[model samples]
Target: MERGLTNRKEVAKLAGVSEATVSRVLNGIGPMKETTRERVLQAARQLNYELNAVASSFARGRSGNLGVVLPHVPKVHLFSTYYFSELLGGIGEAVHAKGYGLLLLFRDPSEAYDYVSLYRTQRVDACIILGSSAIDTERDAVHRLAEERLPYCVMDQRFDHPQLNIVAADHEQGSYEAVKHLIDKGCRHIGFLNGSPQYSNSGDRLTGYRRALSEAGIPWDEAAVYEGNYSRTSGKKAAALVYRDLERLDGIFVGNDRMAIGLMQGLRELGCRLPEDLKVVAYDNSDAASFTEPPLTTVKVPFYDMGKLAAERLLRVLADKASDPCPQIKEKLPTELVIRKSSGN
Candidate 1:
């Protein structure tokens, strides 16, 4: 029985392998025979040896972990809002399979910038910024990370940062297609339920909505646009406002699914029949969208794919392969417009 700190050398000695071999096996690098790998692992376990993650990472010139920063999580709507969770799930699965760890950091813009500062001082190999608006507001933090030369990727957002990689859904195209679907279904007076106008997504979606209306020869009415926070409560409130002018609106395109669900509920309470009296379309085909009274017609953002893409991009940057044609990539995955009962299609 070995005593004291069980370092890699001691484990290698017990496993009858060189210290370098132990390093390779532990770090998941060079191919050691299965038998040899297993023996080294068992010896480390028996000796209660824990590899120094930081030291190992430094030696390899990489940290086997990725840091993800997201907006503050709402207490009531944890799983209902699938944006962060779906992205995190995809990132977790992908990185775990690749023998890496994921450190999820949830904070508002202020705290998020602080975390980025602390991360720079520490040993994180790379990071992913979640939302475009939040990223833009935290540009100073982003610049700090840039100065440190930490590999980072932006998810679900676009920015003009030269060094930051980005993976996002084509929101403009998706919104255009969604509104177009409603127009094709004989809806003329369509309204838009939008998130903050300050966001890039809101601006792009607004553009899409206008484009669709213009192409359909339907006059765009600015009065029909109702701005709301991205939440079911806000959606419901926005819908009530739209309902006040119900005589002027026959359809709606909501920014996200949760708000869409709230809109539907509001309309129903106001005695408006869905699809029959008013049609609705939304973005982010979250789980709740599918179970709505009349299954929601939505544009499905490929959240899982986006997360995986972000992780892969970050890994490439961390590996100092930014110049690799593969890492310098920006992908705008297409969104699918899932037709359901809500849009009367």
Candidate 2:
């Protein structure tokens, strides 16, 4: 298994698969079993095989562009949103430094699109998916990409498939810290406003919220928990429901800054004072967190770093640079709590 002496046949033999299978596995080809993929990659790493070299010799031509698939939500300017913008900023930087083009793709969740066709047609060298949700269609699409053996990674979302690569923030811990911060501020009756449960992070937040409450000797009350779509408007609309619980709920943990901002506005119009009437803390330390009425306290997720790390590693692997170790596909970064006046700090 000498680095210079290694060949495709040797890799296939060691992996106990065919040479063609090795080629498909290395180049990101399609519709294969997870066991086959694991075997090929493990053999490749073991034999010190040049994955990109074999890919170039056997795979289709490179498109010199990295495709970023984004979920298309109606009337929502994704670029205007701090979450997408920061993540893209990091991806753009990595793609540019590598002298590659960045292709922004939009897909409506209701519709179906073949992600592999982008590779088959030579449109993108690799892919990084954004706004992915916990859906069967999404699972199928990424699974197709893995079956095809193409280099790709998912951001801020989780899938049950073991072969799929993921880069995400420590959301559960972020949620826990936000709730704990409120508890430490002496708020006995804490409320939680979480996003829809379609995404795993929503569930993570709920788990963290419950954990903090349980640890603090507070009973878990379903009446105090509300749900929003992680949108400003949804937050505003939820204010009425949250308002009703004001007598018993003294402090609240919001899912994101946008929702917190909207909730604060709705509360003010409904005759509630800021910080004094209701202490608040939110997730995603977006730019507007500071500009809010009382300056919002929130959790800081390393989105930019998440994007950069995923893109950089995938691109480097695509270049067949054996100097860097084989790809570490799944990663979760830490989150920090930024204390501010909104949390009564």
Candidate 3:
């Protein structure tokens, strides 16, 4: 019995079954009789046969692969960006462990139209989108996936798609808690540095910051709010603008950890003492937060857990374990407040 000598046709001939039946048995597809399946398996073992992934998938009418759409991965330092890397790592681990292949697609809004065209072809068995950036432009692709009954899930953003499943952190509550913590630490004149207001996460985080201040009877000062672009440089520039323009700011809440680090460095250059002259708090508790001159106080989101859960849910849907059509699953994972020197906590 020579290895690689037994192809599907040979196995079928030996087992006295059709090539399709042999294919189904080898690839774990069901509906074949027990005796027929055992006969095919026994033949395979005797022949030392290995299934060709491409051929077997073709026979089964599937690609045996999953598609992952992440918006602009390499454009930014995603690995250094904690939230993106953790989510991607979790997704990669879960998919690889399941013995299926993963196809990563990274594109900006303009280039995302190609994915929409691909969805029309029904190429992949299922898909998982990493962030909302892709969805903002490729909404039609998402709609097409739903129309085709293809399984998919959103990782970190909440879109109002009736069919899509979502796994995300509790950004609203986390931001609220972060702001409240600063307030409890005797920060009265708190400033909010935000990212783009178009994204749902940015809006949710802003709402949380506002809600926390309102609850604590602190007046919402529009002058203290500065908008950035979710970049470290943006944070540095915003800090300069705030320091040079605004006066009497006792605390600052940055939208993300990268921005917070930039702001902190900027403040230090301007002779602003941490937790003494101005307290600082940020979101996304990235690794950079811990390495800042004074370790940052921020909200630590379970990004990896979110990725794992999203992958698992998508697999369940693809495997036909989920019976509900167009199931709307909203999973809200918890976030923790990591205390360090930044907030003087």
Candidate 4:
């Protein structure tokens, strides 16, 4: 047994095993006999030998890092929003459990960013892209990733390309269920406060709203729809817009809980009674949804679950890259409608 805990040679000598065996056990790379594994582990414990993760990754021709790319919006707190926060939490949990490092990278949607270079530069073994909007630059980047056959997954965005991998919530179904709930309550005049169309989910949600109206044999009123930026301030503004048709507006379906909360507050200030005069249903079912004055009736999109699935799917792609060069995966998790006081149900 060597006195200093410097190299694998010392551990191997103490364990009476080859240095190759020590490397295998330490790096967790190859399958080994249980008794040999225990012997190597025991020797490492005695010598306090710590594996050098960076060196091991290089030796195996890997970066040992999973990259998460988020849109870079200046001065806007990304984590403050429930969508980004929950998605990140899920990705972090999965990456940590996989014993791989997470490397975060931000790309400005206004500018061109190379998504494929992360794998090319050996910065990451695989990547997951979040907050992909309908911006041309962002779309170009995602397309480049797919064209390059990179091992990556895009969360909450659907490119529909056979080469692209996606994990997202069924936002259209969620929106349909919400609006149908309102219609079942005998509300014919419903207003939709929607997020920006730059997000694919926004379009999907709109599709759902229209589908519900069509199914109910109700005419779609373009005048009652307002575009919000999925922010509290925009939601407040949306409430004022809806007020113009206050007499006709019997129910409202908001795109997200953040906007819904703001809209609710603004409507209250405008002297409108909730659920009695105007019922509301929102999406995201965030933590704040339940604590609102009348509680929120919301569509629960599983952002956390989507994130976890994206991360795990990216890992699977990386693991099978050698044999299966290009893997196409598109997974849509189901959403649930949570009924509460806001919906008058």
**What TM-score against the true fold does each predicted structure earn?**
0.80, 0.82, 0.80, 0.84
Model 3 segments beyond 4 Å from truth? Answer: 1-60, 73-75, 111-123, 134-136, 321-326
Question: Which residue segments of model 4 deviate by more than 4 Å?
Answer: 1-60
Colliding pairs, model 2:
28-148, 28-149, 28-150, 29-148, 29-149, 30-147, 30-148
For all candidates, the clash counts are 0, 7, 0, 0
> Which run of 10 residues does model 3 get worst, by summed lDDT?
51-60
lDDT per residue as tens, model 1, 74-176: 5755544688789888888778776677876766754436545544455355778775474455766665555555567767665556755677889999999
Candidate 2 off by > 4 Å: 1-59, 321-328
State model 2's lDDT: 0.85
User: Model 1, which residues run further than 4 Å from truth?
Assistant: 1-21, 24-61, 73-80, 111-119, 132-137, 146-149, 319-329
In model 3, the Cα lDDT at residue 320 comes to: 51
Superposition-based RMSD of candidate 4 using all C-alpha atoms, in angstroms: 7.0
Quote model 3's TM-score.
0.80
lDDT of 3 by residue, 55-100 (tens): 3433544455677877774567766677778887888788878756
Candidate 3: lDDT over CA atoms?
0.75
Top model by lDDT, which number?
2
Ranking 2 against 4 by lDDT, winner: 2
Error of 4 at 82 (Å): 0.9
